[model samples]
Target chain A: MATTANSTKKFRHRVMSAALAAGVALAAPALAYADGRVVVFSPPSTDNYIAAWQSGLKKKAADLGYEASFIETTRDQSEQDAAVQQELAAGADTAGYIWWPFINAAGTNSLRSLSRTGKPVIFANQYPLEGTESLWTAYAGIDDFANAKTAAEMLLKACDESSTVKCDKGLIVTFPAGFSAGADRAKSFRETVDGKLEVLQEQPAGFTSQDGYKVGSQIIPPVKDDVTWVYTQNDSLASGIVQALTEVGKTPGKDVLVIGGTCHGDTSDLTSGHVIGTEVQGAYLEGWYTMQTLHRYLKTGVVKDGKVYAEATPDAPPSDEGDISRYNFIPSPPVGNSKEAVEGFRLWGWTMDELCNY
Target chain B: MSRREIFMDVMFRTGLMILVYVGFALFIPSYYSVRGVAALLDGAVVIGLTGLGIGVTMLAAEFDLSVGSLAALIGVVTLNFINGAEVGMVTAIVLGVVIAGVFGAAQGLVIAITGINSLVFTIGSLIGLRGLALFMSGENTVNIPVQRLEETDFLSASVLGIFSIPSLVMIGAFVLVAAFLRYTVWGKEVLAIGGGRTEARAAGVSIKRAMVVAFAISGALAGLAGAISCVKLGSATPLGFDTLLLSAVTACLIGGIALEGGRGTVTGIFVGLLTLRFLVGGVSGLGAPFWMQNLAVGSLLIVVIVAQLSVRQLKSRHDAPALPVH
Candidate 1:
C-alpha cells in the first residue's frame, strides 16, 4: 500500500506540471502585446475625403496590431465635448487617441480634456491653432499656408500663358468664414501675390461643387471680361467654375485660367486644361502620416518641440529613435494641367488616385 | 375680393419691389441693368423656392422646419435613381418629387391627428430626413455622371440673355403658388386657417385635408428646386442645404410673412428674396467685407420690419370703429 501511494503522487505531480506549462504557452502572445484600442474622435464622414482619411487611419491601426474605435460627432463642439467625457470614463486600455475637432479654434476645452488623459493625443487632418501646442502630442496634415503659397508661385508662370487674355486680374472664390484652412490659404495666397497679381474679389463660398457653381455663376458674369484668372481653393470648386464660365458664354481656359489650389474631385479638368494646375494635398497621405505619428509617440513616448514637413515618400517612422516632431506636415507640390500630372504622380509612395482622389 | 382690389394689390406690391430694386441699383455697380437683375434672381433661386414652400406652410398658420432636409434628401434620391437605378432623368426627378409629396403628406397627417406643434414635429423630421440623405449619399457628393452632364446643361444656359431656366422655373412657381392661393378653395382654406384657425374649423373646413394639401405642395415645390439645382450643380452633397433653411426663413421674415401664420403674399416673398439677393451679391461684387454685408442687410431688415409694423398699426387704428367711450 505504501508503494502504490508513492506512484500515485508522482503521477499527479507530472499532471500538474503539464497543465502549468500549457497555461503559460496559451497566454504568451497576450502577455507580449495587449492590443489595446486606439480611440479616434472625429466628425461624421460627411464626404469622401474624410472617409478616405478614416480608412487610412484604420489600415495603419490594424498594421500596428491595435484596433481603432471611432467616436463621431455632427460637427458640433458640444457633442464632441460630451463624447470626450464618455470616452475618458473607460479609457484605461486605450493606446492613444486621434482627435479631429469639429471647429479647430472653438473646441480648446475638449482638447485640454484629451491632454489630461496622459495618453498620446494625435490631431488628424486639421492643424491645431496657435497656443494650443501643449494640448496635443502631435499634428499630421497639410499645411494650408504652404499649399496656397505653392499655388501662388505656380500661378505666376501661368500669367504669361493665357493667349488672348492678361492673367493679371484674378478673383478668389474661397471658403466661407469659420473654417480656418480657407482663411489660412486665402490669406497666404493674397500675401504671396500681393503686387504680382491683382485680386479683384474674394468671395466666401463653400467647399463643394454646388457652392462653386452657384457663386461662380453669380460672380463671374459681371467680371467675365475683366478676370483673366480664377483661383478656386478647391478642385471641386474649379470644376464648377469651368461649368459656370461655359454657361455664361465664356471659354474657361481661353477666357480665364481656373487654378485649382487643392487637387480634389474631378481631375478631368486638369487633363482637359480647364484648370491650369493644383497642388497635391492628399487627405489619404495626411491620414497615413497621422497614424504613423501617433504610433511613433506610443512607442517612444517622446515628442520634440518643433515642426517638420514630410517631403519624403510614404512618410517614415519618426527619426532619432522614434521621436515624433510636433507638426508632421505632408508635402504640397504643384502639378501642371496635363495627363502626366495625375497619371503617375506620387506623393510619398501614394498615387494620385490613392491620395488626391480620396 | 374684386378684380379692382386684386389689381390694386398687385400694383402696390410691384411698385414696392421696383422702388426697392432701383434704390439698390443706384449704389450697386453692374446692378443697374437687366443682366444684373437676372443674375441676382438666379443666385436667389434656392432661397426663393424654399421661401415659397415655407411661405405656403406659414399661410396655414403652420410652418415647416424640414424643407431644407427634404431638399437634400430628394436631391440625393433623385441622383441615385438616375445614376444607380439607371432610370430616365425626367422620370427620376418626377418620382423623387412625388415621393417627397407623399412623405410630407404623411407628416402632415401625423401632426394634424396628434395635434403636435409644427415647429417641434418638423424639427424631428428634419433630423431624420437629413440622416436619410446622408445614408443614401454614402457621406459623399452624389455626382451625376459626365455623360448625363449634357442632359442638364441647358438649365444653366442663358434664356434670352436675361434669365436661365432655373430663374424662369422660380418665377413660374411663384405665379402658380400665387394663383393657387388666390383662386383655389384649398388655398383659401389655408388662408382662412392662417387668418383664424378656430373660425375656419367652425366653418366646416377639412382641416386634415387642408394640412395634407399644404404640406404636399410645399414638399413638391421644394423637391423641384433641389432637382433643378442638383442638375445645374452636377452633384449634391448631403449637407448642400445647410444654410438654405435659414436663408429661406430670412426671406419670409423680410417679405413680411407673419410667423403666426396668416398675412403674407407670394409677391412679397419674391421681393424679399430680391432684396436679400441684391444686398449680398452687390456687396460682395463691390468687394465689401462680409461684415459689411451683414450690417447692411441687418439695417435694411430692421427698417423694413419697422416700417411694415408701423403701417399695420396705423391701418388697424384707422379701421377701428369710433367708440364714444372706452
Candidate 2:
C-alpha cells in the first residue's frame, strides 16, 4: 500500500513540471511579438557618457518592457554615418524608435531620413538649423547659446573688479568654431563681453580635454599673468584648461577664471573649487523623456499633441521647446563654485539612485 | 675645392641649413615672442628623442614599429611607480629604463632567431603593446601629478630667456647623437653593416650583437621620450605615441637619412624635425585653417622626396657611358 502511494506522488510531480513548461512555451511568442526598442547614437569617444546614459535608459526601458542599445562614433562624420546606417538597417527589423546626439548637420539629415520611415526619432542634446524640421518627432537638450552666455557672465563676475582688466581680452581656446553649436557659444560669449574683452587668441582645441590641454599648455604659461580668463568652448575643455593651468603653478580661480559649457560628469572639479562653472546637460532626464516618447509613439502612432498639432506649420523650427514652453529662450543656470554648482546639477531631474545607474 | 665636390657638398649643406633655419624662422614671427618659441620647443623635444631611436634603427636597414606603443607602455609604467609614492624620480626612471631594455631585448631575440621580417613582427608587437597600455590604464586617462617632480626642482621650470629647457634638451640630444655617430667606431660599423650586410660580416664585425645593441638603445630612448612627454603634458593616454610615429620617421627621412640605410647625419635629422615643428607652428600661429597644415606637410614631403630621387637619378646618368656619335 505504501509503495503504491509513493508511485502516485512521483507521477503527480512530473505532471506539474510538464504543465509549467507548457505554460511558459505558450506565452513566449507573445513576449517576442512586443515592438519596443530605443536606439542611442553618440560619438565613440563619448562612450563613457553614452554608457552612463544608457544604463539609466535601460532601467526605465526594462520597467516599461522596452529594449535599448547605443552606437558610438569616433567624432568623424563618416564614422558617425556608418553607425547610424548600421542602426537604421537593424532597426528596420526590430525597432520601436531612434535616439541620437547628432555629431553635426549631416548627422541630423541622416536622423531626419531615418524618421521619414515612420519611426519616431529623438534628437538628444543637439538641434538642427532652420529648414531641417522634418528630422525627428521631438528634441531634448539644453540651449547651448544660453549656456555660453551664462558662462561668459559668470567669468566676468569672477574677475578682479579693481584690476581694470577685461575678461573679454583673454585667450579663447574653443573647439573648431564651424558648427552651429560652437559658433553660437563663440558669438554669445563675444556679445556678452562686448568691446571690453579682446580675444587675444582663439584656437580650436577639439572637444576633448586632452586637446584642450595641448592647446592650453602652449598658450597659458607666458600669458597667464595678463590673461584674466581661459575661456573654453565646453566643460571638458574647461577641465583640461584647469589641469594645464594648475600644472603651470597658477590656481584656476585665483590665477585665471575658467568658463565653458556642457556640464558632463568631468565637471566634478567645480564642486571641489578646482574650476569655476559650466553649463550642465540633463542627461538622465533626456534619457527618460526619450524612452517615454518612444513608448507613446509606438503605442499610439501620433506625432504631435492635440492642440499643438492643429497649430503646427511644416516650416516650424526644430526647437527643443515650443513658443509656449515657459520662455522660448531658456537659461542655462550658472553652475557656480560650491553649493551653486550642485544646484546646477538639479536640472538633471535624477535622484542620486538614478544617477548611479551608470 | 674640386668643382664637382664643391657643388655636391654645397647642395647638400645648403639644403640642410636652410631647412633648419626656415623651420625656426617661420615660427619666430608668428609666436610673437621668444617665450612662445621656447614653449613650442618643449613639446618638440619629446618627438625629437623618439626620432633619434628611429634614426638609429633605420641606419641598420631594420625597422621597429613597436617603438610607439612601447613608448606609451614605458611611460605609464614610469608614472605608476612615481605617482603619490615615496619612490624618487631617478629610481622610477631607472626601473623604466631597465624594463624598456628587457622589452627591447625580447624583440631583438625574435628578429634574430626567427629570421622573420622586422616590419611584420614589430607591427604585431605594436598592436599587442597598445592593447597592454589600454588594459593597464583601464581605458582611462592617467594624469601624473607633477608636484613631486616640481617640488624636487627637477621638473622643467621657466622657459629660458631665449629658449625652453625641453627644446634645449632636444638640441643637446641631437648634438650628442651626431657626435656619437661621427666620432665613434661603433658608428662606422653601423654604416658598414647598413651599406652591405655580407661585407660587414666578412670584415669581422659581430653583426648580430650590433643589431641587438641598436634595438636596445632604440627601445630605451623611446621609453625616455614617452616619459618626458608625460611630464610635459602632465598626463598619459592609451593612444600613446602612435600619433608621433609619422613625425619621427619623417624627420629622420627628411634629415637626409636614406631609407636604404647607412647614409645620414643627426644634424640632417634635426633639420627635418624643425621643419615639421615649423609646419605646426606656422599653421596654428597664422590662424590658417587646420587642414592647410596637412596639405603643406604633404607638399613639402613630396618636394623633398622628388628632389632626393632626382639627384640620385642624375648621379646614375652621369656615371653611365656616353654613346659614341655615329
Candidate 3:
C-alpha cells in the first residue's frame, strides 16, 4: 500500500513541474510587451538615481492607470522609430512616447521622426534644440545652463569669502567631448565667471571619478600654485578631485574650493567637507516631472510652444494651465557646505534625502 | 641579424624617445620635477599595461581588439564580486584576471580553428562583452563604499614621494613581458609564426598553441591592468576603456612594431608609450587644448611608422646586387 501511494505522489510531482515550465515559457512574451496609453523608454538601471527615477515614475503612473507602461533601451532615433513601428504592428496600444535618449538627437532630422509618430512625445534629459521646439510636445530635465550659472555663483561666493586662498584663479573639468550637458555647463560657467574669475584651464574628461583623479593628477601639478578654485561639472568628478588633491598633500576645502556644479552620485564628499558645495539636481524629481507633464497634456490635449519650469515640490500638480511646448526643467538649488547638506537644508519642502538623493 | 643592425635599431628608438622627453622637459618646467614625472607615469599605467599586452599578441600576428572591453568588464566585475558577493578582494581580483585569460583563450581558439580574421572575431567579442558588462552592472558606475576609500589610498600613495604601487606594477609588467618574449621557446615560436606561419609550421612550431598562449598572456595582462586601476579608484564604470585600444595601437606603431608581424621589442613599446605620454603631458601642461594633444600623438605615431618603413626600404636597396645593365 505504501509503495502504490509513493508512485502516485511521484507521478503528480512530474506533472506539476511540466505544467510550471510550460506556463513560464508562455508568459515571457507578455512580460516583454509595453503598450496601450503612456509609454516610457529609459536606460537600464545602473545607479540609484535610475532606480529612484523609476520608482518616482511608477508612483505617479499608478494613479493614472495600468495602461502606463515602461520599456528599457539604450537607442538613438532610428532604433526608437523601429521600436514604435513594432508596437504599431502588434496592434499599438501606446498613447504617447516618453523618450530619454542616450544621445542628443535634438535636430531637424530627428524632429521629423518624433512628429511622424502623430502623438504627443515628451523628451527628457535634454532640452529641445533651439529653433526645433515645435516638433516635441514638451521637454523636461535640469536646465544645464541655469545649473552651471548657479555653480558659477557658488564658486564666486566661495572665492569672495575665503581668506586662505585667492578665488581669482580657477579651472573647470568637464565631461568628455560630445556630451551635451557638459558643453552647456562649461559654456555657462565660463561666461558667468568672465572678468570676475580668471578661469585658468578647461579640459574634457570621461564621466567617472577615476577620470577626475587622472586628469587632476596630471594637470594640477603643473598649475597647483595658480589654481585655487576648481569646478567639476558633476559630483562624481568632485569626489575624485578631492581624492587627487589629498594624494598630492593639499587640503581640498581649505586650500582649494571645489564646486561640483550638479549633484549626481555619492554625496559623501559633501558630508566629509571635501567638496564645498553642489547644486540640487535629482533624477527622482526629474522623472516625476516628466510623467506629471505628459499626463496633464494627454488630458488637456494642448501643445503651447514655450518652456514650463517645474518648481516647488514633487507632490505639487504640474503647471499645465494650458500646454507646454518646449522645455520644463528642474530647479538647481545650492547647498552651501557639508553642514547644510547634512543638516536642515530643504528645497521645495523636501530634505536632501528626498529632493537630491532619492 | 648582424650585431650592428640590432644596435642600430635599438639606439635609434631610444634616441628618439630621449629627444622627445628633453623637448617636453624644456618647454614645460614641471616635466623636470619628480612629481611631474610620476604623474606622467600615472597617466600611462592603464594604457601602458594594455599596450604591452596587445604588443605581445601582435608578436603572433594576431589582434585582440577585445582588450578594451575586457579591461573595463574585468575591473568592474572584480570590485562587484568583492563587494556584492562578499568575497575577499584578492580572491575576487585573481578570479577576474583568470576569467579574462580564459575568455581570451576561447577567442584565440576560435580564430585558430576557423581561421577567421582575428580583427573581425575580436570586434564581435568587443561589442558582445561590453554589452555583457553593461547588463551586469545595470549601466551605472560601481563605487566602493565610502569607508573603503582609505584602503584604496595605499595603492596610489607616493612611496618616498616617487613610485607608487601602480607605477611599479606597470614597469614590472614591461620587464616580465620583455624577458618572457626574449627567453622562452614559446615566445620564440610566436615571433616565428608572425614572421611566416608556413615556414614556422614547417619548422615544427605549433601556430595554434602559440596564438593561444599570446592571447592568454595579453588577456591576463589586460585583466591585471583593470585590477590595478580598480584598486586605485575604488570604483569602476564600463565605458572609457575603448580609449585604451587607440592608445595601444598608436603605442605599438610608435614602438616600431610591424602590423605585418615579427618585429620590435617590449622596450621599444615602452619607449613608444613614454613618447606618447610625454607629448600629451607636455601639451596639457602648456595649457594647450585637448585636440592638440591628440594631434601630437597622431603625428608622432605616423612619423615613426613612416621612418621605420623608409629605413627598411633603404636597407633592402643597399643589399641588392648590381643591375645587369651596369
Candidate 4:
C-alpha cells in the first residue's frame, strides 16, 4: 500500500510536468507581466453615470502604461457574475473589477467569487461586505451617506420655504430594497428630516422612475396643501413625480418644492425650473480613484488605510476609535438658485488626471 | 380582384380597427384626436412590419417566437459592425439588411431539416438567440445615431408630408407580400399547406421547402424592422426588442390571425398595430403615470381580443338558420 501511494504521487508529478510542457508549447513567447494590459469589468455600461468614471479611468490607465478595455453587464447581478467568469475565461490576467452593486445582497457573494482568484477587486459605488475586503482593494466614488445628507439638507431648505412652520412637512420616497448606499441614503434622510419636520409620507418607490411616478402620483391626490416637499432617491423618479404634478395643473415649485439626487442631464431639466434640487453621485471620480487604488495595490502591497479614497459615514465612525472618519468626500457643488441651477450642470465626475493615475 | 371580396376584407379589418381605437378613446381622453391617429400609424408601421411576417407564418400554420430576439440581435450586431468600421450610414444600413437575411436563413435551415414543432422550436430559439445577443453586446445599450439615419431622407423622412418613410416602406412591403401570397403559385401552396399539410402533400407540394421559405422570409422582415428601429433610436439596446414578442403576438392575434393557423391577413395586422399605437399614444398624451399606460395597453389588448371574438360569435349565431316549431 505504501509502495502504491508513492508510485501514484510520482505519476501525478509526471502529469503536472506534461501539462506545463503543453502550456509552454502553446505559447513560446509569453508576454511579460508588465505588458500593461488591464482588463476592467464595469457592472454598469458606459452610458450610465459611470461613464465619467470610465473616462477618468482610461486616462489613468494610459499614464500607468496599461491599455484597458471595459465590459458592461447592465447591472444584472447573476449576469455580472457570468461576465466576470467570461472575462477570466477570455484571458484577462491581472484584471481589476469595479462594481456598483445593483442590489445589496448580490455584492458580497459576487465579489467573493472574483476575489477567490486573488486578483485586485475594486468597488466603485458600494462598501465591502465584512470579510470580502480582506481579499481585495475596496474604494468608493463618493460618500453615499454624505450625499444623502446633502440631498436631505437641500430638501429641508425647499420644504421650509413652503411650510407654515419653521420646519416643513416632508414626504420622503425611497426603496425598501437593500444596497448599502441606498439604505444609507434613506436612513440618513430620515435621520436628518425627522423631528424637525412633519413626515407626510415615506412610501417606497422601488428604485425606478415608474414606481416614483406611481407612488408620487398616489400621494399627490390626498394632500390638500400641507405637503411642502417631495424627496426621491433618483432623478428618474423625481421626473415621474414632476410629470404627475404637471398633469394636475399644479406648478411643482410654486405649489411644493421637489428634491432628488443624480445630477444627470435629465435632472437638469427639473432643476432648471427649481422644480427639484439634486445631489450628484460623483461617478467619474469614483472610477478614477477605484482604478488608482488598485494600481497602487498592485505595485505596492500596502493598502492606504488613512487616505480618504472615497466617502465614509459620519454617524458610524471606523471601529478603530482613534481613526477619524477620513474620506475623499467630493461635494457636488450646489446649482445656486432655481434660475441658475438649470443653466446647465457639469455632470460632476473625476477629472482625466484622476482617472488615468488610478 | 372581385369588388365584393375586396370590400368585405377591407371593411372587416378597418371596422375592427375603428372599434378598438374608439373603445380605447373612451378610456383615454386624448385618443380621439388627429395626433392620436398619427401616433397609431407610427406605431402600426413599426410593429406591423414584424407582425406582417408573423401573420404570414401563422397563415402557414407555424410560429416564429425567435422573431423578437432575432430582431434585437441583428440590430445590435449591425450597429456594432458599422460603428467599428467607421462606414457610411447608407452602407451600414445595406450591410445590416444583408446580415439580417443571413440570420433568417440560418433559422430557416433548422426548421427545414429538423421538422420540429415550430412553436416549441421558436421558443427555444428565442431564448438562445437573446442570450447570444446579450452576450455579444456585453449587455450595453447602443444609441442609434438617429440624426445620421434621418439624413437619408428617403428612408427616414416623413413622406407625402404626413406619413413616415419607414411606415410607408412597411405598408409597401405588406402590399407586396400580400400580392405574392394571394396571386403567386407559391402563395397558393403556402395557403394550401397551412390549411392542411396532408392535403398539400397529396397535391404534390414540397412542404419542407415552402415552410423553410416562409420562416426565412418572416425572420428577414423582423431583422429589417429591428435595424430600422435602431437607426431611428440612434442607439441599440439589448432590451430593444423586449416589447417585440408581446407586441408582435398581440398585433397578430388582433389582426384576426388565428393562433391555430390557416387564417389571417397583412391588412388586418397593420390595423391591429395602428390600434395599439393609438391606445398607447392616447394614454401617454393624457399624461397617465408611466406604469398605468402599460397596464392600460395590456388590459386593453385582452378586452379588444375578447370583444372581437364575441362579435364574431354573435355574427355566426345571427347567420344560423332559424329553428322550426318542432
Give the per-residue lDDT of model 3 (tens digit) for A1-358: 9999999999999998987786666444344444535666554444455667766666666666534455542222222322332233233445776776443531223334445678888887765555445557788777899989999988888878888887778789997643557778898999999998887888777567888888888878888777788999888888788888887778998899998987767678888777888888767767777777787778888766666566655345455355655677777778867666556666555567665553
CA lDDT of each candidate?
A: 0.75, 0.61, 0.72, 0.62
User: What is the C-alpha lDDT profile of model 1 across A240-326, one tens digit per residue?
Assistant: 889999988878777778889888886898989888899887776666678888888888888788788875554343342368888
Candidate whose TM-score is highest: 3
On TM-score, who's better, 1 or 2? 1
TM-score of 1: 0.51
Listed per model, the TM-scores of chain A against the true chain A are: 0.85, 0.70, 0.83, 0.71
User: In candidate 3, what are the lDDT values of residues B217-281, reduced to their tens digit?
Assistant: 88988887777676555555565365678778788878877787787778878888888777765
Tens-digit lDDT string for candidate 1 (B27-138): 4434655556556666677778889988989988898899988988898898888888888777877898899889888888888899999899999999999888878876
Question: CAPRI band of model 1?
Answer: incorrect
lDDT of each residue in A123-181, candidate 4, tens digit only: 66654443444545656456666667778787777655654323467677775333456
Q: How well does model 3 score by local distance difference test?
A: 0.72
What candidate 4 gets wrong by more than 4 Å, as runs, is A1-358, B1-13, B19-40, B144-156, B311-326
Overlapping backbone residue pairs in candidate 1 total: 2
Off by over 4 Å in 3: A1-37, A66-68, A74-91, A106-114, A131-135, A206-208, A266-268, A271-273, A313-322, B1-61, B66-326
- Tell me which residue pairs clash in candidate 1: A313-A348, A314-A348
Residue-level lDDT for A236 in candidate 3? 83
Native contacts present in candidate 1, fraction? 0.00
Measured by lDDT, the strongest candidate is 1
